[model samples]
Target chain A: MVQIPNTPAPTKSPAPRPVPTSADVARLAGVSRATVSYVLNNTSAVRISEPTRRRVHEAAKELGYVPHAAARTLRAGHSRMVLMPTLPVPAGPLYSQFVHDFQGALSRLDYTVVQYGATGLRGDDAARAWAELRPVAVLVPSPGIGPEGVAVLKRSGARAVVTLSPVAVEGARALLLDHADVGQSAAAHLYARGRRRIGVVVPEEPGMEVFSAPRLAGAREAVHGTDATVTELSLAYTEESAAALAARWRGLGLDAVFAYNDEYAMLLMRALQDEGLRIPEDVAVIGADDLMLGRLLRPRLSTVRIALPSGRDLASLVDRAVRNPAAAPESQERFVATVVHRDSS
Target chain B: MVQIPNTPAPTKSPAPRPVPTSADVARLAGVSRATVSYVLNNTSAVRISEPTRRRVHEAAKELGYVPHAAARTLRAGHSRMVLMPTLPVPAGPLYSQFVHDFQGALSRLDYTVVQYGATGLRGDDAARAWAELRPVAVLVPSPGIGPEGVAVLKRSGARAVVTLSPVAVEGARALLLDHADVGQSAAAHLYARGRRRIGVVVPEEPGMEVFSAPRLAGAREAVHGTDATVTELSLAYTEESAAALAARWRGLGLDAVFAYNDEYAMLLMRALQDEGLRIPEDVAVIGADDLMLGRLLRPRLSTVRIALPSGRDLASLVDRAVRNPAAAPESQERFVATVVHRDSS
Candidate 1:
């Protein structure tokens, strides 16, 4: 074994107390180490007396003994960990809600959900980093994980490799949520409402290109072979950026706009209103994600409501994939986008 | 040795490809495993030739070899993981922004930030679950982590136990962000505006009680020894709930309301407006966490501007604690809340 130099001492306690082990718990409880393991790990396969279990639990509590997950993984050869690499951008309420539901569902399925912040890493580098943890499954919510990354993860003992991407990734189960549909639906709605000079708000925030690029492409596709002209308007999430965009709005001469999402749309709409632009009369506005705050606005913002797959369903899919890693990778297009018409358009 | 039965096979690969190890990379690169480890782990103490390093890296990439984090921890006796238990509730923009920034800062400091979903676990149980991962540090953003929990984490090799709570937790470094201050600032601002009957919005959402209860107490504290009376208004985040509350607003006979935060304020404000109740004229409204969308509202929402500690500053504190675990626990009151008077109030 290669000696690892400069390994920091694990415990920095002034009088470092030895970590209580199962053997200590067993000695305290007057039971065998196997009995302590069965009790502490809650091995349902073996039945231990209730009083004996209580004794083991009491001893563990008294000694502050908790099983090390890493040690357990090393021994068991697998862990019930579902690694979700955290995206770089701040998750909006819509995304947060989905994550919350997904986590709850995954928890119910007895999987420990872990969100690892792999900020600077991408593709194979990121996959390698995640593989080091030896997670049973990896649910990547971004587009950077290529086929090579999927292969690396599978080779490193990942039972399931799932990706929420615009297109199917080789050797991975795809939770295809095409963002382009959101832009298409919004653009079509505006065009149907007699809007010809169309502008699309592309958020200038870094790491938003994965979603915004596809949405922009969809908007261009919707306006193809039509008199409607599509213009790209770059706007940041800040109020100042919205104001600056609104200040030069008249020069762009766009009659309608499909802001990337509700948050950006709300920012731009308020700026345009401050600039004496009436809602649909001056410039029609539409956004995607259909956030609740959008409906609270004065014009009752029009939006393309995106329906994501139920968290429970996704959890079940993951569970099934984990049970049968050899099963053919499933590609399901569960994303549905429909225009929710309100007063704005 | 205690036998662990029912241990699942590590990999379910159809053709079961063996996981490439440092030894495999060394063999392929015609070098010692120590050389490969030094090059891969970037151990600066031992220098290897550039050509040898390139060969080792190329072999690692070709064989998809990744050093096991668990194995490394076993050898080093510690890890560079900072565990943050994921909160039960969906994070709002303000909280999400803070997490994003904190994760980025921690990443720059070479700490792997991991958000573990300990949904059903609480207090000591939650700490035990986190300690099982053997994280170097535990940053609890919410309450429920007690002295016992701190002890449990520290005993399991956590060098730093940091908490963002209203009060300092025993035996843990405190990032004191009192939620009550937010409510007090808003209530004081409204009371100063000559509004006597104050209504404090308490969100009905589960897991929000930790924040809402403290804020409610603070509002009541602000109104103490005065004619102003504080009433608890339980409201969910949904627009339907806001509309239902707004429908019976006149019956409550409240002169002003301190909505939970800017999101709740905006939601309730729109509902009240829809009910033909002019803001500030009929009932002055104030909220906390001065969100940007609050400024975009027609009445320009008056809010308690909450200034949280810089992510970099918090990261530095965590790093300091990790480096010097025996140092006295630090308690810093970095949360500052001040009311921003706007057109709404």
Candidate 2:
């Protein structure tokens, strides 16, 4: 074992006095502890006169009383929470932006968003770990967990389990978002633009197989369905990787490339330009996830636009499911994907 | 008084008994309640041997013993948590990505990240509202909360307060990252590329002034130090805003624009291209936060590379502060900014 260096001792004293409790507020308001609880929680049942409610509110205000989240969770069974398990991915711009929007939308509905860190866990273990907190719902982005995992979560009282994967689980509601559609849509648009040869970007990341495989499959599906021939190109999301890919662009003889998304498209586009390849004239490029900056390019890059199901819709579904655990599973919904054509394609 | 309509009630009976608690785990493990708590919490004072620990762990695992969060909070006196109060402005891709990374880093150190819904609170009131939970720290984005707010939190037992503002609060350790530096760095690079009449993007969203103001200030500061002048152009993230801004590109007579970041830069770039503007020649564009897709543009976008302090460094600092609250306030640390030159500029 490595010997640890001695650290300086801390000098700070313990904080002054304990935090004021709801009992203090109840005493000050001259009401039963239950009455204070009901007034403070704004519960609809067990009516108190307006003035009495005002008295409890005033006492709470004077004492700086905020309901304890932990105590509330204990009484309420589960938190008014939605947990999204996050993995570190090279999300680039568009996907990152969508996540930001999703968070803001969830906040508007008074639901707390908890991003559970599940870095090393996989499958049923990951699901069981997540279910430990008793979240109302779990939104898994390309879930590594399977049917057994879903069963574990359901048994633990997770009302709704939504995965952004094409494959549906036995016990959970699946949001079957076909990533293949994004890749297919990009390829189809490029093919229609009269490009015979296409390069599909394959990200060189271990976990991206979850996203990249489906996208590649979709691109191949589109290419095989048409006269266009598709070539797979493995590229890591790095300056060096993009430069190397650009250096070999001439040898590949591809007329156009679907660079996965706006980030990869921009990366390769710059490298190709550095290699003296004029976009559209020498090569046409398309990206997916119509990011905000795609249009800012010299020749605006064409991209695939994916619309997420509205936050209101998802939140309402979660609320309903939590209230009635035996309710029938909601039908799987697939969000629409469309193409936004610009100059590069 | 408005009469409320009766809602359809649940048709099926509720599930048997509540989620198994710590008491249940104790019974399953055939251990005393104190022994179970000691093993589960890994309390060092208790000399429970390895076999005893294993037995307790297995029993808790078999019974699915998730500590009731509320009960734990009540017993612990304070939460093992941090609260981040977000403004109404959408946390675009770059900031959102940083936040995600920050959360990951914090989780590694055993801190639970809670994004509080602070929309209805402001200033000192926001601090009071957050203090109700007795979190260990509060991280407010730059320009979101003020000094009085920080003081309120300190009085409420928040040991550490971190903010992204240029100004440091009296008691909090400020991670002073200047947003203006981002725009100035981008503008300086654009000017070096012989582009004149720079356009600075100003987001039209109600709450974006916090970010946009600093960026514009930085751009103007750089331009004022030279012969060029920055034209502040208001653009929202919406398509309509981009189209309108793009349509009047020629009227502004700007040869280059410093977009706030990759997202807005991409939005305006697309709009400009749609309106038939030649990138670099007609209107060179530069964005901040060197996103992966910037290079994928027809002419790669030049950007300001913001060098944020490592998450490990920040977390370690926070932990130290928590352990020693009376330690002299850490001197404000400022991160450096540099320009990443690409084809667009």
Candidate 3:
């Protein structure tokens, strides 16, 4: 029963340790834990000296210390979650890429972005489900939330309720992204290019109606005084549907088309080409949401480009809404979509 | 001082109520809050009658009482999150749809699926970030994680660590999805259809090497015993790359191609068509991942279909692993990808 005595018998290199904690930073800066927290979180109520704050910052950076999000949420009752409800629609590569960018920005702001599934939920039922998360902020996309739902969410202590839709929701701060602008820009571009007969593609998928209906209305508005006519063409993402549409392309007497988005436009365009219609020569085509695939197309797809606010800007808005709470709830830009002319048109 | 004599005189309808809690369920079920919690959560260590459990369920259903996730996490340390780290690869519609289904299934099992942004994180650092949430389980896809990362996660109380790849990581239960099988299947289909010269598309995008390299290797394996030649074609999603490939198409002299996936296939298809090459006549094309966009092409795309285990099955497996932590790890099916035939090849 001999104990291993603490003697300087051998010199061995120490194994790699973990990331630095707040305590480590505080110890290094010769400050208290409260001061470290105050400096790190920018707790304005705390009157820490300038030199002390600078020392804390330098220590934190040197030690590579970052605050743990969950622990912070637990201690403060102010959650770091920015929960984006999963939409019913199958997100294309473009939307996924945009979401990825948003996640990166939100993470930079020390918010943990959580994507929650809300496929068939609506009204207060959906609100109740989201409230279970106790998120600091919730960013909802179209098939925009109703007033009762917003009230429920607000009651549940969501500091920032934001909707990304065509119009602003009453109780939520919003970024307006009207599909009508997309249709108007595309249709107007085609009309300016002197294409009189226009077909507006409406995807037959169930969830698309929210986005497509307004687009159709906008397309109709674009051709109001002109000899141009806008006809709603229902199409699905199946081979049979595309073939049927391509089969009747010549008889429809359409010289140009605004195909809801790049995906649909690419589908319709490929079919038209197979049906022996030379793109932009026999029938001009335009799409919305300028995707990378659009460029690889034969005639090169002309698309309505949505100029979304940068991720940093959106993150800042969320932060402002949470921090201030009483700020005005509106977008600086009412519309973000524009026409990006390519070889197709 | 009268409050409308207990409100019996008025015939007005009542206002909507707030989100239901366990108290409402307890009152309805004629049980204590502890009994209701025990019955609803199936707190196995506590004894409760079947009739009591039924009553609790009925009461909860009637009131639409959902357990608050954060409160449950705080009380029991049984986290609801099945955290999937964001991979470097661009998730197309297929993966997004799959994830959406997974989320729905996991939610039905009272697990919240959270996607964490780990764009630049790796090893223990990434594990530490994920561990901060204290998720019950984590489903990791390829760029196989290290032992240190697994140990960090396990030490932080992750009950289950699952990897979706051909190669299993130590200390993690693995679901083997050998993407190479997809390539082999696609190439074999082309060879069986009498196409000798084959071009295998390898995406030039940074993160794509994880998928594309193995696929190319498998394609070569499919033609090992034959005179058939497999050519590796480097393609990017850009228009210029497609154009450049189209310009050099005449010199490659390939009769067939197995593109990495549907997105890349579609991009190349349009370019080949623009270059005046006839589909299946001058060149045959096939791609892995049966994306919906593929079907709309004139010569409907042939694809390698990777039949992933259903979300419910995956959820059950996760639950099983958590309940029986000492159980051996194994996949029911080793090869997930199957070849789905269509007109393009």
Candidate 4:
């Protein structure tokens, strides 16, 4: 048998190395500090010799000297940062795609996009946390920020405060994405298909209530005075949960179901199929968010296709808001929900 | 019909408002500026009356004065910010969950988490941009940072530079998450199950080469010195692409396939079924990343489940590195890939 050697003890801490500064770059380039600043910052107003500019840039690169963003902000009294608060739960594919697009668009406009994780804080506390960074703009999700939060951010020098909420928020630009319209469109389509006793699925995931509650209310509103009845179905995004729900399908006597979204719909549909139920013939089903995977199902899933303004369009709106902080805030209806007909319903 | 009025012309910019400062709080609290700073900043070395602290807090709240993060960093010579560079591509569910978990863990350690979107930048340019913010730590993805980039960041006062890469970086702590293991596990499992002719999928998505290329190579490595053969299949993440590939499957004469991931596997499986080819009988299919949707299919998917180091463990590693900047950089293997046998294989 081979014997292992003992591990060595940790060494003492090394002495600190001095950080490179602009002065070092200026000395290396044989130029004045003012000249180095003008060349590095690209101050077009003050013209400098091309050779001098090149020398300054080369020296800075060799020294690995970078301008401090905090110092620049202090001098300019503003930052080109657009702050976005990350949500507590993981975002689905659709929202993730939108965020990527938005970031790309903002980058094109010379804005640095920063996502701050403001978990365990809400409303005014969250806003105060964001204000500490002194971002030029703040984009928040619904129920995370209110009028008081908006006031706090603006007081800390934020030019624009925007919210993606169901209703318009006072003192902020509102990008209205009401979940009710999605449920209304899905339920109305089912009712038109002559399916009665419809059930609406509510996801049991935490942080989903902000969206699921509005959808449930909208479904109830669709069948308020009609002979068709709407029933609430609680489901989780898991195979076991879906199988348990499908096992009692016959007792519920429902003719159709509107799963929360395409993911939940796929889960429930598979479970129902395992329980020996026929699609459309025995129980019709529909879902929201027309994901690509929905079409892979044998009976292609019918869904509510939700449309929001393009990321480029929203970026342009934010730029306008930042430029004109004194102008009255605008609230636009941005949600367009429509039903896509398929074999599932 | 109601008459519509023309839109109003744009208004001129309004007068700028005066920003409140700590002086205003001091005046409101009827205390000196030094006392206000000690009370608000919670200076442990100084002793103050409880009633005085309450008065300072009430005054600050009324004035809506927030200490600037930039100013505090200038004074402290360091910050509690852990900067992460956001990837260009939209992250999948597994990665998104890991990010949320990591952020939560970092927040619990009293560190502020900020994700910077460094679009249109690479290598040293990206490092220079991040260094401008003076972050205490930076966590970057694979192929984004190199030895020179790490040196630049260290010179700019970054205490911890970590990278999630397949191989260990020269001067940074590396969290090794090799994609090759995922493909190797899947291919080895298929070979053990009597699969002879195998095809490995490579996604055509632009930013996916960093992951797909290694996986394809690993699959080839698995079939070396055996009677089995490996073929490469190029595919896009779309139904049309899958259908087109499936249309030509008969001429290829492949008996088994290792799809890039479960999402692509589902798409290909559906297309093959539409082409009248039965799963496991005509061709055995296996995928990497055991997603939940894989089990919902008619024939449960066989996959390579990848286990990564927990977020809490990574957070602790970062904290230790930050506290001991002079210590030697460490690299640890953080990926464990295993195959889950199911009906498809």
All candidates: TM-score: 0.94, 0.85, 0.75, 0.95
lDDT of 3 by residue, B12-106 (tens): 43333555778989999999999988887778999888888999999987776766666676576557678888766658776777677777777
For residues A1-345, what per-residue lDDT tens digits would candidate 1 score against the true structure? 987999875755577777788899999999999999999899999999999999999999999998888888888777999999998788988888888888889998899999998458888788989999999999999898899999999888899999998989999999898998888888999999999999998889899999999899999999899999999999998989999999999998999999999889899999999999999899999988888888888788999999988777888889999998888998999899999999998
Ranking by lDDT: 1, 4, 3, 2
| Shift in Å, residue A43, candidate 4 | 2.5
Residue-wise C-alpha lDDT for candidate 2, range A1-345, written one tens digit per residue: 865679665565755645567799889999999999999888998889999999999997776566765567667766666777765553544444445556666667666666665245678776776775567777777667788777667655677787777777776777887888888888888888899899999989667777778888888888796778989999987989989999988999999999987777877888888899999888999888777557666678888888877655665666667667677665575767799999998
Q: In candidate 2, what are the lDDT values of residues B1-345, reduced to their tens digit? A: 765679664497556445676788888778888998888777999798888889889987776665544455567766667777654554555666566677777777877666664335576776776775567887777555667667667756688887767666776778887887887787788878887788998987787777678888988888786788888898888889889888777777889998888767877777787888888778889888887666565577788888777756776777787777777776665667888888787
> Candidate 3, clashing residue pairs?
none
Q: What ordering of candidates by TM-score runs from best to worst?
A: 4, 1, 2, 3
lDDT per model vs. reference = 0.90, 0.75, 0.80, 0.87
Task: State which candidate has the highest lDDT.
Answer: 1
Which structure among the candidates has the greatest DockQ? 4
lDDT of 4 by residue, A1-345 (tens): 765668566667877677788899999999999898889878999999999999999999888898878877777667888899998789888888888888888888988888997457878888998988888888886566878889888988889998998887789999998899888888888899999889999999988988888898898888889998989999989888999999999999998999989999999999999999998778888988899989999799999998967878887888889989998899989999989989999
lDDT of 2 at A65: 69
For candidate 1, what's the RMSD? 5.6
Candidate 1 error regions (>4 Å): A1-13, A46-52, B1-15, B26-36, B47-55
lDDT of 4 by residue, B55-147 (tens): 999999988888778877777767888889887788889888888888899988988888997467888888988888888998886576889
Q: Distance (Å) between predicted and true CA of A209, model 1?
A: 1.2
Residue A303 in candidate 2, Cα distance off native in Å: 3.0
